[model samples]
Target: MKVGLYFGSFNPIHVGHLVIANHMAEYSDLDQVWFVVTPHNPFKKKNSLLDDYQRLEMVYRATKDYTKLKPSDIEFKLPQPNYTINTLAYLQDKYANFEFALIMGEDNLKSFHKWKNYDVILENHHVYVYPRISGNHIETQFDNHTKIHHIDAPVMELSSTFIRKAIKAGKNVKPMLPEFVWEYLDEMNFYK
Candidate 1:
C-alpha cells in the first residue's frame, strides 16, 4: 500500500486539510493519506495547541467518512518535538510493506532546507507539494531530484490559526470545518 503522510498539529481539523488530503488521494499516486497528528512540532509554538488527544479526536471526526483518509496518532507515542525525518524513519521501519511519501505545502518546501536531515528525506521517500496562496514567488530547488513531485492540489486560503481565532472570538467556524468536527468542538467547548 502506498501512503501519503500528511503531518500537522491539526489543532482543529478543518475543510482545507480535508480538501488537500482528498486531492492527494484522488489525483495523486497515493492510495491513502494519513493525517499524522503531531503532539508538538518543533517549528510551531506549543502553548496555543490543543491537547494531542483532542486534536486526534478532531481529526478522526473530520475524516471519519472519508475512507481514503485516516487520522493517525502515531506521533503521540513518539518522542516530543516531532521531526518529520524521525517520523518518516520510524514509519519506514515499522511499516515495511507500505510505501510512504511526505505530503506538504509549497511554503514548507521553501523552508525545507532548514529541516533536520532533509537530504535523507528527499532521497529515501517521495515528497508531494501542494501549492500555497502565499508562496508563488518561491522556487522549488532540486528540481531534478527524483523523489520531489509538485502537484496541483487546490489552494485553500483558509488556515487553522484563523479558525482558532474565530472560535475564540465566539464566531462560528462551522464553514471552515467538517460538520461533525465542528459539532465535536462545540460539545467539548474547545478553544474557550
Candidate 2:
C-alpha cells in the first residue's frame, strides 16, 4: 500500500488538515494518508505543545469517520525530539509491505536542509508538497532524487498556537475545529 505520512502535533485536528489529507489521498497515488501525530518535534518549542496522547486523541476523534485517514501514534513510542528521517526509517522497518511518502507544506521545505540527515531522507523518500505562502523559492534547490509534487489544497490561516490562544482567552474555537473535538477539549478543560 502507498501511504502518505502527514506528520504534525495536531493539538486539535482542524478541517483544513482533514481537507489536505483527503486531497492528497484522492488526487495522488496514495491509498491512505496517516496522520502521524508527533510526540515532540525537534524543530519546535516544547512548551507550546500539548501532551502527545491528548493531541493523538483529538486527531483520532476528528478523523473517526474517514477510513482513508488514520491517526497514528507511531512517534509516541519512538524517541523524543522526533525527526522525520528517523520516523521514516522506523516505519519502513515496521511496515515492510507499505511504501510511504512524506507529506508536508511547502513552507517546511524551505528549511528542509536544517533537518538531521535531510540528504538521506530526500534520497530515500518521496515528498508531496502542498502550496504555501512561503517556500516557493526553494523548489529549484531540490535534486533529481527528491520527488516533490505540488498540490492544490486549500490554504487555511489557522494554527495550533492560534487555537490555544483563543481558548486561553475564553474565545470560541467552534469555527476552528470539528464539533466532537471541541467537545472533548471543553470537557477536559484543555488549553485553559
Candidate 3:
C-alpha cells in the first residue's frame, strides 16, 4: 500500500484540509492518506495551539466517516518540536510492507529546504505537491526530481488558524468545518 502522510497541527480540521486529502486519496496514486497529527511543530508557535489530545480528537471527528482517510497521533510520543523526517523514518521502519510518501502543498515546497533532512525525504520517497496560491519556485527548483509531482488539486483558502480565530471571535465557522467538529467545538466552547 502506498500511503501519503499529510502532516499538520490541524488546530482544527477544516473543509479545506478534507478537500485536499480527499483529492489526493481519490485522484492521486496514493492508496490512502493519513493525516499525521503533530503534537508540536517546530515551525509553529506552541502558545497558539490547542492541547495535543484535543487537536487529535478534532481530527478523529473530522475523518470518522472517511474510509480511505485516517488520523494518526504518531508524533505524540516521539518528541517535542516534532520533525517530519524522524516520524517518516520511524513509520517507514515499522510499516515496511507499506510504501510511504509525503503529501504537502506547493507553499510547503517553497520552504522544503528548511525542513530537517528534506533532501533525504525527496530522495527516498515520492511527494505529491498540491497547488497553493503564492507558492513559487517548485517548477524551477524541483523540475528535475522525478519524485516531486505537481498536482492541480482544488485550492482552499481556509486554514485551521483562520478557523480558530473565527471561533474565538464568535463567528460561525460551521460551513468550513465538519458537522461533528462543529458540534464538538460548540459543546466544549473550544478556542473561546
Name the candidate that leads on TM-score: 1
In order, the Cα lDDT scores of the candidates are: 0.88, 0.85, 0.87
TM-score of each: 0.93, 0.89, 0.92
Q: Cα RMSD to native, each candidate?
A: 2.0, 2.5, 2.1
Worst 10 residues of 1 by lDDT: 135-144
Which pairs clash in the backbone of model 1?
none
The deviation in Å at residue 34 for candidate 2 is: 0.9
Ranking by lDDT: 1, 3, 2
Candidate 1 to truth, TM: 0.93
Q: How do the residues 66-112 of candidate 3 rate in per-residue lDDT, one tens digit apiece?
A: 99999999888797766788998899999999999999888777788
Model 3 global lDDT (CA atoms, 0 to 1):
0.87
Look at candidate 3 and tell me the lDDT of residue 161: 85
| Reference-based TM-score, model 3 | 0.92
Residue 157 in model 2: lDDT: 70
lDDT for each residue of candidate 1 in 30-51, tens digit (9 for 90 to 100): 9999999877655776677888
lDDT of 2 by residue, 81-187 (tens): 66788899999999999989999887887788888998888778888888765534455466344377777777677788888889999999888898889999999
Model 3, runs deviating above 4 Å: 41-45, 135-140
Q: How are the candidates ranked when ordered by TM-score, highest leading?
A: 1, 3, 2
